[model samples]
Target: MGFEELEPIFGELNVERAGEGSVPSRRFLYHVHAADPSHLRIIVTDFHSNAWEAVRSIVQLEDMRDNIGIGGSWLEFIDYVLASIKSQDAKLILEGGLDTVSGAANAKLVAQKSKGMPVISISLTELVGSAASAAITNLSLELFKAFKSIHDLYREEKELSNQLTKALAAEKERNENIQSQLEQYSKGKKLQKISSSDKADASALLNNGLENSPEKQTPRDTALTKVANRVVPVYRRARVRGVTLQDTEDIEDE
Candidate 1:
């Protein structure tokens, strides 16, 4: 589709066109910002004419734009874009027509670079024919919808994974707390048992002492009672002898 047709669909996006005269051929770049604040950059180029030369020019342009001085084969650009996507900074989609054998091979490499991003592949000759043009348009729309769906699903999956990790951590903490409380309770119960045993032993010793003390002192009490009985009879005899002991002796002699 022409820029006029795609403009309405992606008009809200931040658009930047590269390779007007600076580069050898024409190239367009569109940066789309989603509701989730995630960004997707789409690169449109034609490499069917001179694959190697076009690749070199594209790489140079990219290097200059990013100022990273990246050097390697053309396929390296795909790798760089994939790395950016993996880092979650932005998503990249490569769109081009596969006409020559080199273009097809490069397209395959580009598709492989993207782990899950969609590659929009179209035939250069197809645009000229009216029927093929309609089919391509439909195909483009379907691919865009599919890409959006996949991106949403990926975000949701990441969110769910994070939530599950937090839940697991919370559960582990709760279990640890419960185990600590149980240990404390067990210790308390053991201490109570020890205390009760001590009290029972003391009570048993006290009762044993009480039971044997009376038997141990009974002989001493009996001796004291006998001594008291003998003293009382002597005291009564002294009281009955009123006369002097000498006069009583003389009367007996006479």
Candidate 2:
């Protein structure tokens, strides 16, 4: 939705976006909006995940913003998130060789002004309490991992269900196809018997073949073939796919 819909979520978070100058090693809460809900409704790119780790805070965030970010007006929320890092006796201690995080021209200028030491000034863009941001970031990452795992499992189950449904349909079709072929063979046999036999015997045999003998003759009918240019087949497939319909002794008679 729009900013109005986000206001309630922001109210829950009780914080806003922290900048690059947030260097106080304490805790603070903040929120960052992602995108529209309908198109891609995922709540990724949260401030709670990337904030403290991006700036590496050792302390917690709860100790930082006092009555600052939430349930208050917009100006109060901004004031809560935006604060310069005031390091009281927190000067950088260069333990070893000169290690500057930045190699910019302005850093060189500041270093020249501060004697031969490399310039290491805090950037005004960081947030107020880094440790708090980092804690939120850790929690958010765990949630995301859990969400992804659930999503993957759901997809796998759906795929398996679809495959099972397809297999069942194919089996049903194959059974119906074999049944039709068997009926055709039985009808052909009955017609031939009628042409050669007398009235009563012919009728009885035809009725018997249609009823009691239909299922029994399926395998036998499949084994015989019509002429294909006086050869076994124009093209032949193995009987590996055939469904058995006869008793062993009866089939051996063929």
Model number with the top lDDT: 1
Task: Report the error of model 2 at residue 217, Å.
Answer: 46
Clashes of each: 0, 18
lDDT of 1: 0.43
- Model 1 Cα lDDT, one tens digit per residue, 1-254: 01221221221111111212122233322222221212222322232232110122343335443554446653464455444423422212223433322222322112222445433221122122444344335435755886788899999999999999999999999999999999999999999999999999999999889877856668778788678777557767888776456677798899
* Candidate 2 error regions (>4 Å): 1-128, 196-254
Predictions in order: lDDT: 0.43, 0.38
Error of 2 at 228 (Å): 67
Which ranges in model 1 have alpha carbons more than 4 Å from their true place?
1-134, 214-254
Task: List the candidates' TM-scores in order.
Answer: 0.36, 0.28
**Candidate 2 at residue 8, lDDT?**
13
